[model samples]
Target: MSNSSIYTIQPIEFRLDLKDPFLFTAHHIDHFPAGNTQLGPTVPSTPEKPYQMYYGDVVPGFPEHPHTGFETITLVESGFVDHFDSLGNSGRYAQGDVQWLSTGNGVEHCEMFPLVHQDKENPFELFQIWFNSSPEEKKQDADYKMMWREQIPHVLQTDSNGHQADIRVVSGSFLNTDALSRPPHSWAAAKENRVNIYMIRLEPHAELTIPATTATSTRFAYFYNGPLLYIDGQEIPFKHLVELKPDTEIHLKNSDQVASIMWLEGEPIGAPVAMRGPFVLNSTEELNVAFARYRQTHFGPWPWPTPAPVFPREQERFASYQKGVDVEYPERM
Candidate 1:
């Protein structure tokens, strides 16, 4: 729908087309069956089926891959993810966790979704967003950081009708709650950038108001889950994205069923973007240079034994940074 408050409404596919300052976003929801000895689904995923094994056959995920000139923000809503990168960082993070990786010049990373459970179904859901980096920031060294579920901020609000709205602040401030710190070289590092990513859930028949930001910022609301939703009293269907006016307050009213929405807003980078495969750069010439560099260095050699490494079945949520001390979280019940 086109209006003064909304620019466009588009149906969401596997990969979402985002605007400046944001390159790409995809929502992955896979209902994997029991795992075999290889930690992959007992029933292999086919192209026409609901389950997708993307790049890995033994393990259902992308293997060692290169990325440049962008940052990956992975939010795991349901299941766990095993992350291995060339910088010698590894981690196993689960539901409610967020992994922010700045690829800087270049980095090779493996994201394997291990079906930890062997006896029952293993359902996994995650949202991965590719945020653009400035020309200068793209040349810095790679960095990886994890925001555990405990460290991230979650806020709850209830309207006069007592219907509640649950808000998870992933990259920006919501109400009085602030998100965890981002990588130093991230485009979101600057407060003036006004980069914000929020995951909001509304109870049945709930009403919530999204506060306004600067007019210069770009804003979008994606109605990903649940039934009907009303934005500023306008009906919004499921699996649809609306480009919102950043300077105006927006009201969201959910139907009788619970609803989930992903809200992304940020000031435009206003830089020329040239993308080729996994490389994002300013010009085509720069992308060519990135490709040549990756071929020459292989993004600093993969230290892990296999491109897709499956951690022990009993391993809990933990992070082993390249330089920092390794840390482990309490085992989930």
Candidate 2:
């Protein structure tokens, strides 16, 4: 019998992999000379800090930029990301937090990595995925949201041998757990789309089977860091990408080390794509129109104090919307 699941498998190469400033403290003179001040990529760790700056200059982030006709989902694995938008929304979110922005029609935004720690290094790691929007939704107003770490659902499971797995549901439903609410215009918010975004961590030697959901939806797993993972008797090394068929379950076996993987599944919009710089649209005409409009208006003018504006240094994790709605996340233990 032919199995109806598990399709193309590939490896993922990050467009930008950054590990901030490498340390050379007095305690470890052997690793660096007395006055070594150069900065570059460092060893990767679970709690990555002071991530090397992949791009940008003094501020170490993407300063004011324009985006239209698409949405960006930024998952913060470590460190903090400050967001400022033309709509006057601003916030600073850190570890385990997520920022979802809908740049419908047009908008200008900035993502700056602010080193909040004084006595220690400020490490940062994150994934920014862009999702295409439907043509109608692309004309809607922009939406800015912060998915606080505490609000996102974490699903945990253990086997008979005590091996465990934890799945962080960033979007879509996982087992009995539903992802925190998404913006209204998001394609992931529609039930028919079957979009699933999850961060899965498996303990060493653990085994977990992810049940199949929608048969026609697209699904892919990005194994960013791990020793080894076995699927269908195939050995998947670290930094590999595995694509699975949506009709059947996925059996995962972690080798000797902890595994960190990202799961992204969604139905293809199947529309013509015309993308240029920060905008994604249906056709060349639409793309040109988006550019002309932004040039004419500057996306309604950035009202924030700075291009890479951040909240007060003492402020907690919170989002201040343009319409006067403010939501704050309480301090976590």
Candidate 3:
């Protein structure tokens, strides 16, 4: 068998449609002139703001939308996300906080980037990963939870050379560290499934080994930042997605000053997936039903006062669910 564990390393293509209102800005300090302008006419474009804005006449981010049949794990690396849903769920959280939304049956939601830093430029970055569920779990009720920054397990591993790697265990187990917790209906809930989500940052010239999966599973490593890195002696380019083989440890070496990567691994569901805008199901018939129900209900009406909502600048990280569940976290670091 080949010694290489990587299956594929594909670069993500994000061509910004200027009018789309979504901007992908990373690596640079975005400075906005002090004013009331939501988005300046001559805003500098980075990899982050590819689309510029999406229905963000007031703020920048996705507007009201609907989803079903899947879950969204939004890990915020920098900046805060204001969330509202048809089920009366709402939250305002920032850095290192995670929003795990299980939109099992159906739910309407809105994710807007409220400009909390109006006095200066509003800079932010995050990742929203979608996890599929079994056919039986698709018909369950909708729910969500927030993983606060302090609750997430952060471990630092140092090599013999004194270089260190900061590892954030978002889900699953790594080394001796475990994640905060996952939703009951999540695919990562079962230990036998061997699902893992980790964010690793390597100091220059650092070397680290990512543990292997127990059974046959799929693992994806997203090289989002840092200089070129060597994985098992193979060079990994920037902004690439590397798919690795199951049951093999990943030896990574940072060739340059510093590097960071996001790792996602789990057992493949091995089931058919029919996906449409904001929906995923097993068949076209189910997709059609989701659309029909969304049209009929409008997701129980938008409860928030505005399509793009923002909390007061002094507000802390918090989550409030439909069934009177509420959670508030300390200020984000």
Q: What is the lDDT of every predicted structure here?
A: 0.90, 0.72, 0.74
lDDT of 2 by residue, 4-54 (tens): 455655555554221111000001001111111212123332332223343
Alpha-carbon runs more than 4 Å astray in model 2 = 1-5, 16-55, 323-325
| Clash-forming residue pairs, model 2 | 6-245, 19-51, 19-52, 20-50, 20-51, 20-52, 49-123, 50-122, 50-123
Better of 2 and 3 by TM-score: 3
lDDT, model 2, position 112 = 75
User: Which prediction has the highest lDDT against the true structure?
Assistant: 1
**C-alpha positional error of residue 86 in candidate 3 after TM-score superposition, expressed in Å:** 1.1
| Model 1: lDDT of residue 306 | 91
Worst 10 residues of 1 by lDDT: 324-333
Model 3, C-alpha of 258: deviation from truth (Å): 1.5
CA RMSD of each candidate after superposition: 1.9, 7.4, 5.1
Per-prediction tally of clashes: 0, 9, 16
Q: Which residue window of length 10 is worst by lDDT in model 3?
A: 16-25
lDDT of 1 by residue, 143-176 (tens): 9999998888889999999999999999878878
Error of 3 at 102 (Å): 0.8
